[model samples]
Target: MNMNESFQTLNFLPRGKFKVELVPGVSKTNFLSICYGALTTIGLLTFISYSTNYVLLENLAYERSQIGTIVGNLQVIAEIVLLSIFLPIGLIADKIGRRQVYSFGMLTMGLAYFLYPLATGIAELTVYRVIYAIGMGTATGMLGTVTADYPQNHTRGKMIAVTGILNATGVIIVSLFFARLPKTFADMGFDQITAGKYSMWIVAATCVITAVVVALGLQKGTPTEEQKKIPYLKQIKAGLAEGRKPRIQLVYASAFVARADLVIIGTFLVLWGTMAGKDMGMTTAEAQSAARIVFVTSSMSALVASPIIGYLIDKVDRIKAVSFCMAIAAAGYLSMFFINDVLSPDVKPLFVLLGVGHQCAFFAATTLLGQEAPKMKRGAIVGVFNLAGAAGILISTGIGGKIYDVIGPYAPFVLIGFCNIAVSLFAIYVSKTSPDVKEA
Candidate 1:
């Protein structure tokens, strides 16, 4: 059967609002499958972020005073693993099909989850995390690459917006329901350790299921048409050389802070709230549930703002859009300094602001990359973009964790807040000096 004949047009949204224009050979089926993949993959990742603290506290019996450092170290280790593999994975994705790489990543994550709860010590858990890092780096790298691959330049923002909405939806569902699974199981008469294990296993099963869905539903074969013509080494060099452009440099910068913004929220926000809950005499599971409420508040706000941000990105110069996003991110992260209690209802509005900021930064960076990256080298370029992100995670988490223990939970938020402001300033300068070349 002809591949193009087998695929269908995208009809997921109204033509008037979305104005989607898929690249040649991409079908509605491919787009929708990508959307579903976005929903599950991010949901699974968020669940892991929220649930890790529980594993440490409930299963491993790690000291609360030390958790900040431990989680930080674990993330640093993961980032190290990711840093080594991200570029190669991108190069490989260009060589193979996105579906095969993506499916393998999901399966690897499943294996990590299955091993996570079984860890009797931090050492064993670190080994499992290295596995998780490889999977995470691959899946997330493709998510960015494929997102860039599927949409036409004119409609790229809207496409990104759609996926962003799905990403937030995944985070919300996982945060609201799946994050509470350990607590839910405990309420069902299971002990803390047993409850934690069962909850993780359930997530593991979902990872396996998601792997199957991605393998079957996504468009198959290498996205690069010139794969055979271009020498492999030249492809890598071409991807790197694009960084000579000031705008791509800005994209790389945006990616750095953008990823840090995400990790800070995912790793620290919940940890902050959970520790606060414990201080208030709550159980580990109860503390985690309380933390998720705040986390969900941010995700919910991001969900509501997605379409608006997407439309805005498509209408303006993407570099300008990035500046606007970073300004918002700066505001949101800096606001943490004023909040004394993360678990307080009064603080929900601040979280709402934070969520919007996060969504904007992510959307801006991705849409800009999608717009600027050459089609033939998209995978490798996106890989380098993700490498910037991995570096951000390594530095931010590595230091954020230590200060989280020494100074306060708010310290990490403040640190990244300043970084966002720096990028926003850089974007503003780039817009004036080296505006994006208008797409032909």
Candidate 2:
């Protein structure tokens, strides 16, 4: 099918469909990249639902106030582990093919999911989560690199938009199935814990299959421009130096906001919605289904928003694009402040706004990072991007959890709103002062 025809069939918004230069020739690599994007999102969404649900279950099993403490510690532990290994994973991927690292990361992630339901206490869960973070951290870095690697400059935006659509679709599908799976199973005969475990095992099995597919389907490519002639420390020093560029700094900052955007919604929104539902006298299963609907709404918005945002990234000044998106995100989060009820009908528009903002910022940030980073050092640079993201998730979850318990259920969203505004201002400053880097 022609590009225009495909866009027509997808029925994108009138403003979204645009004339573009298309790349010729399709290959296994392109298909593998799409599959990897979709699979990654599925894995991520399932894990997120599992973690948040586990936190809610723990609150009931233990003390409610510990909600903040447990979730905070889990995130802090996982981020710390990710921070430690991310650079090393990138360095290793640079040495070997990205396919090997990608496959290994997927395997490790599957093992971690397999172990999640076996945890008897917070300590055990923490241990498994740290293990899970390694896989997550590695896969996250390579996904960006691989996506950057696959498409020509003219087609890169379209490729990214397609990946984003697939990812949002994956999240929607997983959330639809597994978000209520425990409750669905409970209705049949299984206990809550058993049902949760069954759902988790399904994710684990899928992760293993994804890993095998990646190993078999992806072709080997030389990732680095040259073999490292420098010592490890010097290469590390060089990668660190690259982060100091003005545009690169902005991308790093965007990483902070983008990751925080994701972690907040995934961690807090589910908790808030579920807790509110439970307070409304809903059963655990019913509460979870209700809570998960928020993500469904958000993902649906992102699925539609992706192509438009991707097109803009290719056409506009990237920093300005990022600033605009962040501003929109800030407004979305601000909408939460006036929301008295988590289950209110008014909430969906706010989430839709949030979803669009996050997806746009995600595309803008990663595209800028991919375009600006030195090709030889791209893997390590993307690692730095993921590292900043890890820090954001750590800070957002760790501090936001406390705010949820201490200030109010909605206070975390308010804080995130302010953070978004702050970053948007920074983006504006970068756009004005720095020379624009063309994507090609």
lDDT of each: 0.88, 0.73
List CA RMSD, all candidates: 2.5, 3.6
Output the lDDT of residue 378, model 1: 82
Backbone clash pairs for candidate 1 read: none
- Give per-residue CA lDDT, model 1, range 1-440, as digits (tens): 12234343343455455666777778767877899899988878877676579889988888989999999999999999999988889888888889889989999998998899999888999999999998888888888888888887888898899899999999998898888988999999999888888888888888898888878877788875677477779988998999989988998999999988888999999999999999999999899999999999999999999999999999988898899999999999999999998888998999999999999999999998998888787887888999999999999999999999999999999999999999999999999999647451
Model 1 residue runs over 4 Å out of place are 1-15, 438-440
Score candidate 1 by lDDT.
0.88
Query: How many collisions per candidate?
Result: 0, 0
Q: After best superposition, candidate 1 residue 6: deviation in angstroms? A: 9.9
